[model samples]
Structure formats: structure tokens, C-alpha cells
Target: MEQPFRVCIFCIRTFIHRVLEPPDDVKKLFQDYSQNGTMSMDGLLKFLSKVQGQNNAKEDDAEVIFNSLKHLNIFPRKGLNLEAFYRYLLGDLNTPLSPRVHQDMTAPLAHYFMYTGHNSYLTGNQFSSKSSVRPIKKALQNGVRVIELDLWPARNIKSVVLHGGNNDVEVRHGGTLTTSVKLLKCLRAIKEFAFQVSEYPVVITFEDHLTADLQEKVAKMVTKTFGGMLYRPEIDGLEKLSPESLKKKILISTKPPREYLETQNSNSPHKSEKTSEEQGG
Candidate 1:
């Protein structure tokens, strides 16, 4: 018999009961935490803090419990202490503010984590309009804090979710083709889907791959659709452009390296333009 799927409410975690077993220690800790009604949230935090500092438990085991508690709202929502707790749990010391093993007790984790839906999907044509919606909805349903979409310019330079294209049977046409959805349609669909899921503060990030003209149009469309809800990451070439310009236009991926882009003079005419200019001169 096949196992049933179960979705956990607290952390928006999900699993197939048949295929996976819960970690015994983690299960015991959670059961104990729930049974200890007298234990305050602060006490729980302190316990985890101490456990994290001791470095006795394997890092992987500790992280599973920490994330589980996070979904259960057992930890502080935000603060310096929570930040340190996250760093300790992740075993990350890349930042300058790494928690001190002995003296530091504060550092609060950020309240949210962002993820994309298509990560685990095995479908080759996963970028299509229909195929993409399932993961997007799943992410929203599972409390994915933020979502990123790769937008490519299609016919008429219209933006749509997908980076590149080829032939495939699962797609609308028999074989692989280009994206058929428009930027506006995608935005509206996302807004409606997110609203239905009751996931507020949806962060929609756009990874734009388009020409200058198309970028401007896509940016305007997003701004009109979501107002300030849309997010565009800082690209390398864009630093020279004013913030206002960026806000008004869709941001492309990190621009070509400054050295390469600068070396090619914009004033040089194209073959056609050069021929015309030379003939006129």
C-alpha cells in the first residue's frame, strides 16, 4: 500500500508517512516540550541556547529540532539573540558577528525563509505555465516565505516565467516551444493564487533576462500589478543607474562585467547603421 501525505501546520512541513520515519530523538523532544505545559517559551529558548552552546549533539540533528520548533513558534520571533541562535544552529561562522561560544547568548533568527517551488520537481518541462503553477501553489500552501521567478522575454518582448526553451510533449504544443504567457497574466495569476492561499506579504522576486526596452516594460507592468510588493535584485551594471531608474524598470541579472561592457563603445554603429552613416558622410 502507498503511504499518505501529511502536512504539518506549524512549520508548513510535509512528508509522505509511508516512505519516511520521524527521527526518534526529535520526536521525543517535541513530545516533551508539548507535555511540559508549565515550561514557558523563554525557558525553552534558554534550553536550546544551552544545548547549542554545548556542541554535543550532531549539528544536523540539532538543526532538525530547531526548524521544527520554529514552525511551532517555540522560539522568539526576532531579536539579536534569535540571530545568534540561527548561526549556531546552522554551524555557520561566515559572518563577523558569529556567536561567541562562551559569552554570547543573543542573536535571533530572521522570522522567515524563502524558497522556490520547482526545486524538487523531476519534470523536464517544469517551466511551462501549467507545470509551474503547481509548485508555486505548493510553496504558498507550505509557507514558503518568498518566491523567485525567472522571467525571459518572449514574442514582442513580453515577460514570462522561464529562462530558455526547447521542444517537449508535456508543453501546450506537441513539441518544445517558447513561453505563451504574458507578464501581466502571470502577475495576475500569482496575485489571485496567493490571495486564495491567504499568504500575505508574498515576496515576488524577478530574475529578468531581457533587452533594455523589454526590461522597462516589464518593470512598469510589475509595479502596476503589485505596487511595492515586487522585488528586483541588484545587478552589477545597475549600480551606475539611479535607484529611481531601477524602480521604474525591471532589473536584469547581474549586468555583463563592467570591464567587458565598458570596453565595447556604445557609440560604434551596427553594420547597417555604420553603412548608412558612412554613405551619408
Candidate 2:
């Protein structure tokens, strides 16, 4: 099932409003600190001193802290924007809503443990199950940074997502129960939900079984819908990207080259290799 775009927007807006709205006590504190619709640096220091009463503030330390707040635009040359000040003090206005882990971004991609979602389209059992875009929204909301898509060609339709080995092109579970969702619907859901929970990049792993024409359609839709948010190797380049460099972007991981796959298969250990030479002889 596909959720309306407006519904997604409304949910995001409501969440933002809830987070940014100050509580009654906070509002009263801000009002008490404000003089002429703004709080002066002195007033802010007083409020901070009261909150940190146990730790005595040194003359130079207070000046340095005040300067830092000024640098953050929390305090302007005229005075402090009380609403902005309150939000900053409460740590509610930051994009990620959590402190970022300081890591060496130049490290190889293998070092990171990506938050991944498996078989993201189905809301229930893989066989004889229902498929919906709701799963994508829920995964992203809970911070699943990598999502899977199983794509198949559909007759008289562009494409659909399903899990079945049958040659039939419709979206179904075990070639039995049909799902109403299509490829575009799932793509739309991703676009809507990807960045809501976190500002980090999202990676989509596609398992595609579509004709070249339909694949082109998929590519076009992705580009048109996601626009600058979708990562392009031509612009961003083919080098291994660091987490910092790929922030707020969407990346797609497709099947590797046949040669690479063949090499992997050849290098893989087999049961035959474990057999004793004497037994084989």
C-alpha cells in the first residue's frame, strides 16, 4: 500500500513542531530573561550562572563562553534571539538530534557496520504475504541506513517489487498472493522517508530482474524524483567516499561485474576441498 505524499509531509512537520516548541517553564524562563523582546549577554550569563550554580564561573571563562555563543549566532550584536537561544540550550535544533561519533572518515568502507534492512518491501511473510511501502517508512524512521529492493518486470505495468522465482511478472508472494505496490510507489516512499530520522546518507541495494527498457525507466524516475539528493559518480567521483563526504545523499548498490562474481565463486571453499585425499583416491 502506498501512503499519500501529503501525509508524510504532515507527519514530519508535526514532529518538528513538537520538538521545537518550548515547555511552559522554559517559556517563562525565556520571558524572565528577555528585556526588549531579546535577552542581553549579561542576562544570558546570569541565567547560565543560576543553572550552573555549583560550578563557579571565572571572569575570563564566562567571556570565552559568551564569545562562543556569539560565534554560533545564538547571540547577535544587538541581543540574543530568545527562541533560538532556548532551542540551542535544550539541544533541540540540531539536525541529527544526537552527538556525532568522531571517527576517521578516511578509513576503508569495510570498517563501518551499516544499519541495514532486509527484504524491506514486505510487511509480513515472504510467501503469501502483503507488500507495502509502509515498511520502508518504518525502517527509515528507526534509522535503517541501508534498504533492499527486489525488483521485477510487470506485464502492462512499469515494474513491481516481489519475492518469487516464477517467470510471471506481477508482484506476488510465492507466485500466489498479489501486492498492490509498484516500483515507483516504493521509490516515492524512500524519497519521502530517507532523511527524516537522520541526515546521514542512505544506501539502497537493488536486486533487479527487469528488461533494459524498464531499467532505464527506473533510472529516470530515480534521477527525477531524488534530484541532487541522489549520489552521482560523475559529480561526486568514483573514489571511495567517506561518511562525511556522502552526508544527506542517497546511494544505490547494484550487482557487481560478472568477472568479479566469477572470481569470488572460484575462490570460495567447497566441501570437495575438505575431503581427505585418501578417501578420494
Compared with the true structure, all predictions reach lDDT values of: 0.43, 0.68
Tens digit per residue, CA lDDT, model 1, 1-281:
13334465444434433323345664454445433333334434545555434344354544554555454322544322332343333444323453333432122112223344432211236434243355555666675535555455454322223432211111121124424334455465565555444323454555444556655666566677766545455474433444223322222223433333544555455755887889999
- lDDT, candidate 2, 37-82, per-residue tens: 6876676667767754524555564455445565553466756666
Q: On a 0 to 100 scale, what is the lDDT of residue 52 in model 2?
A: 41
Instruction: Return the TM-score for each candidate structure.
Output: 0.34, 0.51
Which ranges in model 2 have alpha carbons more than 4 Å from their true place?
1-108, 155-180, 235-239, 256-281
- On TM-score, the candidate that comes out on top is 2
lDDT of 2 at 234: 67
